[model samples]
Target: MKKLKFTIEDKKIAELLGRQNFSTRESAIFELLKNCYDSGSKTCDIYIESNCIKIIDSGDGMNQDDIESNWMHVGKSNKGYKNEQNNRVLAGSKGVGRFALARLGNSAKVISKKEKEIAVIWETDWLTSGVKETSVDFSKGTIIEISDLRDIWRWKNVETLITFISRAYKGGDMKIHVHFEGETYNIYPIFEGIKMGENYVSKITMRYDSGKMRLSVTIESDEFRSEVKEIIKPISERYYEDVFDMINEIKKDEVEEPEQYLKELGDFSAELYFYLGRIGIGKEKFMYKHNEINKLDTGVILYRNAFSISSLDGKKDWLDIASRARLSPAAATHRTGNWRVRQNQLFGFVMIDKNKNPMLKDLANRQGLEEDEYYQLFKNIIGFGLSRFERYRQSIIKKIDDKNKIKNKQKENNKNLKHFLNKPTTVTKMSEKELVSLVDEIKDIQREAKEQSQAREESTKQHKYDVRILNVLATQGLRASAIAHELHNKRNSLESGYKNIIEALEEYGFWEELNSDEFTRVAYKNVPQTLERLEEINIKLIAFLDVILNKIEKNKFSQKIKSIKNSLEKIVETWSQQYTWLNFKLNIKNDKIGEFRITNDVLEVIFDNLILNSIQHNELKDKLIIKISVEINGNTINVEYGDNGIGLSKKYVKEPKRILEVHETSRDDGHGLGMWIVNNTLHMYEGEVVEIDGNQGFNMNFNLKG
Candidate 1:
């Protein structure tokens, strides 16, 4: 091999590193802060002067030899290679972090010292030459002064810069301060209450340990009674692949062992604070401030160690949450897809300890992680966690919206009532003759009111009767279907038994011998067993069919008074026979009850629908208990109907009246017309059902005019 040395151009390389290595001045500044952090700095300060910028840190500084070998070297760093730095994991690996100085300005001077050592001063003019070292007496800390400023430091830019530093330094021991003109800015104050917005505040914390990722999320709002907290384990390969494919447009190859891939990413924890916008619940003052901050800064930010990843900052949707929302609008929980917390609605930090995640490396540009399997898997895991948060947020928003809708409806009703009450009434001053005419007018008005009341009552009664009829018809249809199904099964069993008897007779040649003992046995004993079973099935079928036929035959509505007790007893008997699985208990205080104006057919319809609804809706885990207690108090009969089955949900309790609406049911097989019919039927008799307290199952009390 011939001895050959590649000559290098330092000026061109320096310019390239300055312009291409870092994306912006803010990113370059972040790199410098990382260095301070790695050096065990507890405080870092940035001073923006008219002509120059200076960065100072209270960290263990470098010596002459240390500066020459490490600080001056390009593309070579030992910071995160082994992880043995005073029990603190390093944030920088590439030596190019020093090139961040070059990105800032062409000339720079650094003065640094260790405890009980002479300070070393280094000067570098990238526009001209390399670094020069000297000695100086200074405290045990580092000070970097750049004289040639590259970019204009406007007030707005400085404000943004301070915000970036503050976000990066959150939850870290290090504190950063910025000085511009005469004003001083600290990082902590800017980030306070940054997560809360008008309608909602959300917090998500994720911890990774032993190949498992556990995420805990909390959503809170004044609109709701309690905050919701959920802990989730994100470990499914299919979930990761689904989210990954959603963003990348190409499906990633499935990992054979996903747990192993998670292990490789190492232990890390991240906390995300999101503001849900004006629709969220909070004070207007704080909301205004939060909204302003949200406009400038929002995103799922990534931080290694405690320092933020530069390229992942400021409205960068690395998780692609917004895109997912747009793609599936209905799938989004908030009012609009944009209402979902996107990159611009969030501000947070992801903390990763380098010692645990030694393999997690950044790309050369320092924007984000290397596009390797481990990094991709890490992104997918975070995305999965966010997706879950979105879903929870949606549910919370829906609850809030429902409550708001009810409130709005109530307000509207009140407004209408107020308007009606406040309406102007006509008044006229009149003579004695006119006063006499007024008396006559008053009498006519009273008569009209009476007639209106009577008409309204009749209309209500007619509506109730119609509802009852519909409910009866529906219940009968269901019962008929059940009976038909049972009949078919019973007929099959009977036919099979008959076929077996005939086969036996033919096999033994019993039919040929008329008076033989074998023929007698077949004809009498075997044939009778089959016939007895058929008879029993036929009787049960006929009884069930008879109940349906009797109801249909007397379906015509009538005004004939009927005995309340007798009607209830008949309903109980019919239902008990039809639903042999159910247990019915009736406690009628007055067995010989007063006659009701309602007809027998109408009463039967109401009872049948209620019984059928109980059977169809209630969970038949045990012997379903149907209890009916009736007490005749004067002209009104107080009736209580209950069942010992799965009770109604709180939703139904809050709005019991909704249960009576047509086509409203919780059961998948229900026609939703049963309760409507029952309600209407009772209305005809000027009766109403009221929800009653019960330990188990659905219970209701109603009053009927007798």
Candidate 2:
């Protein structure tokens, strides 16, 4: 075989490694800053003049040997390739980044001096620059002067460079100052901006040492007292079970101690700050800081040896946080699309060392980390921390929300009760600010609802009402504000209550909810409260419809006495079949079904309410059995109904008929309306329904007008 050596071309190689390494002009400059960081520089001062750029740093300067062996040598770097020195991990390892000077300018000069030696001057066309000894007075740091710029530099480019570099190094001991147009600006710590940045509502600290990961979050109580809560997940618990098992299968015998596989990731400490809130994100503070935060690129960032790593800035979702949140969202289900603790809501940094995490190396292009097995483990671990923080955040929020909901609901129920009872309510005079503040809070809750839900439409309407209230308060003072509160109550009653019931019943619409005097937008699926809400709204709507029906279309049989042969049986069968799991069985002990001059629909309200009450109140029973006894009096029909349930609610146990009043029962919706509807309809027909309490299950006795 003939011996042959390949020809080497320096200029083409320089172009390939230099200009081809970065995607933008700003990143080319960033590469130079990384050189300063690798050189142990504490402060890098950059100057941008008309067509020239100068970068000077304060650190231990390099000698002729370093310039020849490392800086001048192509494809040879020891910075991140080896171990850490003097408590610093190299921000860069490949020797190719220095050639980036060629990408920025045509000519570049380097001046460097050791603490005890004279200055060394070197110049290059980015391939092979000449070096000479100099007697010029110089400090112990490297200085680079680049001129003959290839592209026009604008102030916008300066701003972009500033933001790019600032996003890299989270405010640290190392400082960067840029001088442009005779103005010098010190880069500020990004996450700790003016208000929202400094005042994060929640913070989570995570550390991995040995083989275990430790996480703690600062939780604030309603009293504003803050305490750290330790989160302990078993080290054996795999965040990526399939990936781990697959890798384990690949390793087979080599992975004798499979549980210790996470140790390959080495150790790291991370601090995550939730900025949108706990720096106590209230409605007022959120509104004040929202615009400022929205303008910044915010996400979890990674740092190596206290220096920001390139390509891991906030602009990139390297951890896949936003997508993960958008996919699952967990407890943030009420808020659509994204989780409350997702990427944009957080400012975070993970500190890893190149020496400890040798495998977590940057890719050949220097754009990002190599997505290897260890890197996947690292990302999975970070995802675990985020999910835990999200859970903790949701738990705290729900606690506070439940407490507030109770208080707000109590006040509202009292107000609604007074309105229904025709009693005077104590309305206090309010200042414009207080009234506006109150309206803002209500709007805030509406805004808190998910956009895809009907709650959002309610939110929009409420917002318009809030704006009108504010406008009226601005003009009319306390008088207008006071009148607004009264209007709010009246509007809710008439619009939400009567209006909703009239539209819902299809066989009539949703006839069940008409019992209550107040209404709310319905839910997505069937719940225990659905039937209760339907009937309250239904009773009134049905009764009102009955009155209207009598006026327009007359039924000759509607006024005549009719025998109630199978009226109660059909209602029982429909409901019993509807809730098959309840295993309802109805027995009629009386031979004669009641006869009445009433319509079958009117008889339905009495038996239907009685049956609905049994189903609502019975939770512990395996099955419900209803026993009925019918009696035909001289001019009226009487019936006794009883069910095997948990019996009536405690308050209604004594005077169960009182449960027939609106908002009287334990059901979350206006359940009393259902019974109240039955009561009123029975009364007009010359029959009344009463409750039998202190009995097993529920018992009610009522009669029909004959």
Candidate 3:
């Protein structure tokens, strides 16, 4: 064997090749693209043939001498100069990218132009040396051709490609022209909508200048919502964590222009479209990232310099601006789309021009910028977008409320039907004697139950409206204390001011003594006035307390036993008002049913409580039905109340431990102490209350003995 004699420098190529593995063609192609970018090519074309792949560019082509010295050389590079005076910033690094082209193919050739009087062509073939080690040359203009493409081609994800391209488009001066087969792809900003085969496009521009920097944005109209959202979401979520935190020094009350912060973010445009082809690197693909704005369902496609890009998607999560408010399904999608539009990918595309100038350019070709404060004007609107997510949250809550209402409504209707079905009707068109007997018995039972119920009703009603003694004491005392504090401050100021005024009067010798009217005016204007105001406030405070007391009492005991007819009427009336649909039919089977002897107050309390509960708990919108029946057996009277309120939760019955007796504070919508009170009142009347669980409605029966 030759013993493989090799030097340390020779080992460098081996190391470089070992490090650059070609697992996927995407990794290699990216390297090639980077090379093109560094070489200052406005466009780089990639073509794959049967046995070879080629890349061509319009950059500075090298001469034979330059190719041998630089292009054919490995791991060596030159720092390129930038035309800073004209605001042209070139890519500063290049040597690292050449390896990609070498790693992707078995051979390469280059034709480039070096200044005037010089143009050269160079070629390296791995097939000959079995490695990327040699080079040969010809004439000018830059062209690199490598054969045996299978040496490095891999499948590419178009979506990711577009995203990468979109980011690179930030410079704005470069445009990528891709030719796959005979079809051509143009990678650039679609500030206006990008259309293929006669699609429509609209353009709009936005500008922001705060003196420090100026930004001008042009985008498509249909995609505005999506583009705007994408731009802002990052700012609101990442850049400004507690968006309010951005104003740390300013108190909430002091925020006169809350939009100021958002405006400072600069101006950008949003363009939406129906469709567009993709660009960029597979890993670096920003299409999905940008396309996310389109998912907002705003019906707008985003564009960057005439190319269709990203959109938004997903339910109205925290990203929605109107999330806290109820939104039509369509509107929710719209909000989400708009949010995505305001993102970095979309907004970042606008700072440079078609020629890649960082200085914001206008439609008029005017070189100046708009005032920075002008951009601040839209801050609140952006805040509104942030708030949309909250609005979605609120909408969900409302949905829950609506669902409960429907459930309760169904329950009430089913109960009503069951009760009506269960009750026994008059036996016949027979003699009066039989009908009268049945009638008498029912009346007797009802009358007895009503009387017994009255006692319980009276007890609860007595203090129903009374305020909680403790709360009244605390609230009144607090107000009084405030009044005292205010009066103390006033008195000090008044006394000092009054004394000075009197001294002035005495010095002027206008009067020998201060009169009551004059003294009163000064005191009223200063010290006593505060006290008087406090007194008025205290009076109002007492009145407010009284109102609370009244409400509490009403809640505890509206009426213990209301007449069955009246209770039924009220329930019917309420339902009628709420559901203007069908008029209800309530039949109190009381002919055999007597004027049930339940406390009109207690009965009313129970009836109203249940009715209100039904109204609040159900998710339906329809008229309600209720049926009541009274029966007597020896000394006991039984009264039944049933409705179609969505059936009671079996949990409430079977799991009494879990069922809240007081529904009010239960936070389960609006069931409250009324249920507790109803149950207790029944107990007070020496009665047992039984609930019947059904597939649809709830039924309750009270058996009382007087």
Candidate 4:
């Protein structure tokens, strides 16, 4: 090759890169900061005055030769071949960073000096007289001063600019200081003071033939810590048009596995930090300035190659957290499900190494990554990680709610007990003997009345609980019957298919051909195998139908006297299988308590309602623990049932009897029928139910006449 030269209009090219490359003034500033960072700058200072803007940095300054060859060139940089400088990876490579100055103002002055070198000054009018060089007094540093501001800079804009600078340059040893008038603010210290309430971290590394992609998510708060890891599948074609469609195109052209399509995209890693607001601490502990944290633009920030991506900065619903919350209100609210975390409650960075993710390139406009297969896959992976965190957070919130409820109940119970035990009395108007006797009588009467009141209250609550159970059982029964009917229909179809197969074989002269040894061997071998599989299916269907029928029949209330233990055990066994996440513990202190006049239906309704309430209302991540203990005292059998779940609210706890009121339920979806059924069933049996204090979950003590 003899020679190759490229020519372009300098003014036009600078304007294109300056105006088209950046979407916002903040991004333009970020580009300038990135240049300083790449120059091995340890400290960068920004000063915004009435006349001009200045960015000064203590970095490895460039000499006249380096400036003439590299700095003056557009679209070509020495950074492409040698990626690292000053023990740090270069953040800029396009040789367009100087356009940031043009984007900011019309005129610019740059003074730079390298160690043991004479200082040089470069002056430029972006529109004409491109650049002129001269001598300066600077020593071993770089200072950029620009005049003629392009846009109005309000106080809010300056605040946002400072925040952007703080978030963009967090890693490494560099320090950024901003000055407005006489006030000076440091970026690092403000960033370090962000207070969080809860945290969850997840790291997943997916391996392929070529390389591996690593994803790290950190959700931090002042109180909790959790982590999870799992492999996620790529998005379906119906969801996004990029990744799946591209893969399908590849398959149409070549014979290859679906996995091969993903393997070609290469590998990369991303780290996301989620800040879930303050916990049990005051606002004074926060590192972020008050105005900065309260800004409307606060959201999850995205970065590529150690610099913030301008398009994704201040984007509210990048992950669609708010829309998801709106769709599922129960999951997003504080008390209901607590499964959603909004965009405002989060701030983090996602870093993708350029060398690894070759396919994941930036768009020409610099708004976001290219809408390619790799980018779609990356979004799906991140969405999966966030979903996992939500589930974990929901469980934690449930536990906290349960603990607080129990604590508050205990405090109330203690206060009431103290009042009852320490009632004041006057003995001035009566003899000592009469006073003592009268006081004893009054105490006995008050105690008896209190016991009766509590018993009535518990009986009402038990009824409400019972009604809910019956409703759940009825719903489940209908579902089971529907399934059984479907199975019955399938069984009939299988029988018909069997008959058709046999008839077809016979009609096709298979029986006549069976006389031949070869035909006979094949028919005997294959026919039995097919028939055996059909028989096995028929057996399973019959067994399943029988189980369903047994449960339905047992639900019919009877006047028979059954062993309480046996009835409870059956109900427990059925519910245990249905809710495998729950732990059922049964303790029978007296084995010879004999039989009681209670039907299986009553027991099923009671047990099912309690178990259902625990499962539905519980917010804890741990398995629900339900304890059942029975003891024979005198002529009555005492039964205690309790669970470690979020108990009833204070209103319901104080007035336990109201729980039995028709249509009264703590849940938004409740029909308010379960507890009503329980109350009526117990009344019919002449049994008594009382709510017991000192137990963590919903505790009930009932006595059945033996």
Candidate 5:
């Protein structure tokens, strides 16, 4: 035999040949899969036993010369020029995938046969077992059985793995069978809406501040139909592109304030994309995108190599990664390999070298890509894709309009047909209440749609009755709380109030004694009185509702002040009961004070949080004097709420942010959300929350706008 030089050292060869350092064993497996993919395998079988991970592919089997020369070559090309399949250019071409088998297993065995009488057998231990190269003849296809698995990252739920893989590959024509812990999970494909036309794929729609744009793109597809959906699919594709373009164009437009549009677009589109895609992506055909995808029910999955990497970003605008809005390649893709990689961060990227080697970097640390260039590129590409879609959408709309004009004769027929097709059968007829509820739901849906479309006609959507209340308060300069109190007092005096309504029903011959005219008069007059009573009840109900809903609008100042008063009262009462050793009293400056137009919930939370802090944490034993006072000056409401308790640490006083953030509430003690809410609310109103300096006791000074 000719002398073999073997210039590469054995130790160096092992280090270079063994693919390791993957975060998970699943990733290592994906690397093995890429090896089979490069070998021109249409389908590869993965079998997982208790102690082994076996992979068998129908790709071309390698002979002894090929195995030793190419397979064992650490960084040699597996498929340099020929990697495309089904007109789709394969992403992995790196030779590093050969070492993936070793990364996932302690020992790997290969049984491959070319057109020869005998099959070839090659064995090698990943750790310290010298490369044992032998050649026997197998029947035909390559069979790779890797055993003695060390770090196989097996998923407890194979479904998770399948979902991950499906997203990674865009649900390509490949199949993934994950055999894990007694069950096998098969991953299917994910395609843009099947009902939606193929044109909708890779479209970008955006909503900025008050501007709305629909963008999409259309790739040529074989399937064509005259159905509305067929037309819609293409239109949607164009719309996706159109919307993205519109957002980009906003910056280029000569608007009076283009920056506003840019800022708003950046903020809003995150939600718009997530929700739109979520809703439009259907579950049954999760293969297709639909509206439900944005619902937060079926979370977004980032996938690589047919495995989920992280939770999908929700319907929220992200200023970061906005440039990636239109570039389809940058979006995550699926894998068919035994090894894959997954990432879950605001912005993440994985670079695969020409040799199929993967390297990852997260954009969160502000590494990789310049900021200005990043934004500009994002704007340009997304705009480009969107504008194309918009044009297509316009064309489709024109066609639909022209078709409608010619089909006037079949209008009724078409209406009937649409009704039959779109309407669903109900198990039971809806009651009037149910019908009314449905109407409310439909109205809400319409409102949400309008919001998504950037409908700016803010022509008061509140109830006329609600409007009257707002007008009365604004014009009369009467506080809502006082008005509520007045109404309650008035209702108490009237016989037709709650007390009288019950009395009337219990009265002697209440129904029969009244004539039709008298009964009608009572009913008519009672309407407003009834409404007034209801309003009184609503005042309380709305207050509670506001807390639950985080209602920022509607009687915010009064509600906030009231909540603070309530908290102070509770603190006083609690101290009186629990601490017999101490006495705490709240000194109120006035009956009605601090009319700051701030979020009621926030104000309440702030006061409650602060007061509770004083009671538990502050070293106040007896005669604790708490002052709840307010002063209004120059479009601002200055509040001085303090306690004669041990003041906060001096260090924390100087660095308020530190104290606000670091302070954790004991179970017995309330968390600092009260102070936080106060600080946050003050900040929202262009105000500040600071610990008053030169104070012996703990004093929180808050400035709020009226």
Candidate 6:
């Protein structure tokens, strides 16, 4: 048999390695930069002109012999001696990285020189022909002049390119300068706008190596200090709780198998900066650009050997962060207000390289990570940290919001009290008792405010201790005042009950008559139909006392229980007795988590308002139906409250969440503070209530631990 060699067509070979390898024009440009860095270049300048793109690098330039051996060789890279590398790792290893020229342009000319040798030139009309080499004028380095442009680099494109360079290349010794039409940009302005946050919520750094993953997290949102923030202390203290509480908080995860993190995968590190409030605070122009960049190029980029992977430059969430954000849209990035640490709120990068993370391979297209086990493990480990950060972020945001709501509610309460005290009306003038009640309420608010100030100075995490009390008391004050004002007609039956008992006794004497026998006679066999009426009045009196205790009493902050079944079932029993005509049903599902970490008082506030709102707004046909379903999974407690009276009101039908706001109500007799209290109190428990749409009734679901 004769030895045969397969002929490879130059055009057919270029077709697969040129534009086909790079997915974006930015990626192509980045590949060329990687070449300069890999060549041990300390300084590189890029000039963008009207006709051509020129890149000049002060690196180990190619000689004529070197060009013929390596530069001309397809499917091969120039590595050996250059990568001895003076402590710098080579970024371009795929050999085909040079075809980036063909991806950006149809023709190119290269001039290179090495010490003590004549400078050489290489020319090619890449689309139509092959390469040619000769002598040239360049000395000590290389200059690549590319023409026949494919994609024009616009202002935004340059800005994006600079961002990638700033993030990826951290070698302080190397210098990169970009020259546009007339403007020159270094690395400063590309990211200075992102540092405008007053005080960042956190800057988390995580590293994986030696079969272990360690995270160094710094939290700095002092503005959110006075809220009930979830810290690592409590979690670390819980014996039954997860050591990795943040990762455990994930409700929906697509990754099923537990990949051994940092086992086969080599060493890598990630740094994430979370900006909660204002980004680019004062620089309006820069803020506009930063926000625009955040829409795409503003996420976690991947860097290999200090050079960025252009396709993974956060324009696409290779981290699957946006997917998690989509799972909880309420707290994700918003167009206007109330944005928490969603996907876009975080800016960061993950560093890896071919020598260390050889298994985490980029596809032949140089776009995505190969869909393999290594990629899955890489994402999973990083995602665990992300999920943990989300919980921490969500905790901080909820507490901040709860604190603000408390302050606003307190201010409104004080304002209303002052209005009533300064401008006394007919009711206050007529009833000294009502005036006294108003004075007591003002004193109570002042006392609670003082307690809050003291509690805040003691410990920010313990602020929830006061939050529980204040939420219950504030809602009670608002709702009680409104109901008391409107209960004039409802008092007639109570007055009649007292009048009947008094009449039966007053017919004789004050001291001689009003005894237990007289009470019993009114309770059992009074004149005609007084017995049934008296029994009903007695039950109403008892129910009234229970209401006073639940809403007006000081919150037992120490009463945090693991099982919500005891507390919730008790609530159902109490409500059944309190509203004798209403049918209250409680269903418990997935009691695996025991119950929840929710306080007893906060639980009452959530369910009470849901049930009360049903009675206040809708007419009862036979008996109002109140159904509560509680399910536990992991550490989260989910509860759905539904009533069979009516669907959502027309005013809040479109946006059912509107009913949870501070002064939103449908009933004339409603306090409007009921649902607001329900919403805010839940936030204190790391919980949130979302209104769900249904056909037959009003339904809302909430989580005790989110």
TM-scores vs. true structure, each candidate: 0.51, 0.52, 0.32, 0.50, 0.36, 0.53
Candidate 4 global TM-score: 0.50
Model 6, 262-345: lDDT tens per residue? 455777878666654343322221111122222223577776656656334557777777775543334321111122246656
Off by over 4 Å in 4: 1-16, 47-54, 63-69, 72-75, 80-86, 105-132, 140-149, 171-189, 193-493, 511-706
lDDT tens string, model 4, 1-706?
7998877676677688886667677778777877777778888888888668899987888788877888887767777522355556666766777888878887888888887787777777765533445565656888899888887776787888887776665555777888887888877622354432223222222222233223333333322322111111221111111111223112212223435545656554444444444332212121211222222244555556666553245663555667755433343212222245566655454555556566677665444677666666655555545654564455454444444445445642333234435663434455676666666666655754664475466445544544455567689878988899778767666557666766787899775565556644775565645666886676666656755766577446555534666767877786666556778899978756454445666666667776776777785536888999988665567778888877775436544655654444666556666665565556466565666542357887876563
Which regions in candidate 5 have their CA more than 4 angstroms from the true location?
Answer: 1-20, 83-91, 127-138, 152-157, 170-174, 180-184, 192-380, 383-706
> Each candidate: what lDDT?
0.63, 0.60, 0.42, 0.59, 0.45, 0.62
Write candidate 5's Cα lDDT for 1-706 as tens digits: 8878657654455455554334345555655655555556666667777678777776666777777787777556555434464432343444455666766666788887766535677787753433343554444567777887765444653444455444444434455566667776665544333322322222233332223333333333212233545535545322222123333333332233444434333322221122223223122211233323212122233333232233322222223233333221111110100000111111211112222212221121111223343244334434344333333333444345345445543533333223334764531465666556556656655654654343222123212322443365355434544454555455434424555554575585453434435544776555444655775665554443333333234565455444445645754564455445445555544334445344444555556566666767655475666677755564676678777776665334533343343122222234334444455456557677655542467777777664
Q: Candidate 5: minimum summed lDDT over ten consecutive residues — where?
A: 333-342
Clashes of each: 9, 29, 140, 26, 74, 0
lDDT of candidate model 1 versus the reference: 0.63
* lDDT, candidate 2, 1-706, per-residue tens: 9999775566777677767776677777877887787777789999988889999987778788877887777778867443245465566777788877877888899899888987788898755568887765566898888899877888998988887777776536568899999999898666555232334544566666634433333332121222211111221111111111222112223234435555666777677666553332333311223322332455667777645664444687787867775444333322111133566676667778777777688766566788867777777666656655564444444344344445555643333324424643322454566556556655655644432254355345434533443355346544544554555455445346545545656357454544433343445344326755765654544443333343233453364424454666666666665565455444444434344355665766577777777777775567778777766766577777777777765544534554654334565443255665676566667676644664676777887565
Candidate 6 Cα deviation (angstroms), residue 559: 27
TM-score of 3: 0.32
Candidate 4 worst ten-residue window by lDDT: 235-244
Distance from true position, residue 458, model 6, in Å? Answer: 30
TM-score for predicted model 1 compared with the true structure: 0.51
Question: Residue 345 of candidate 2: its Cα lDDT?
Answer: 71
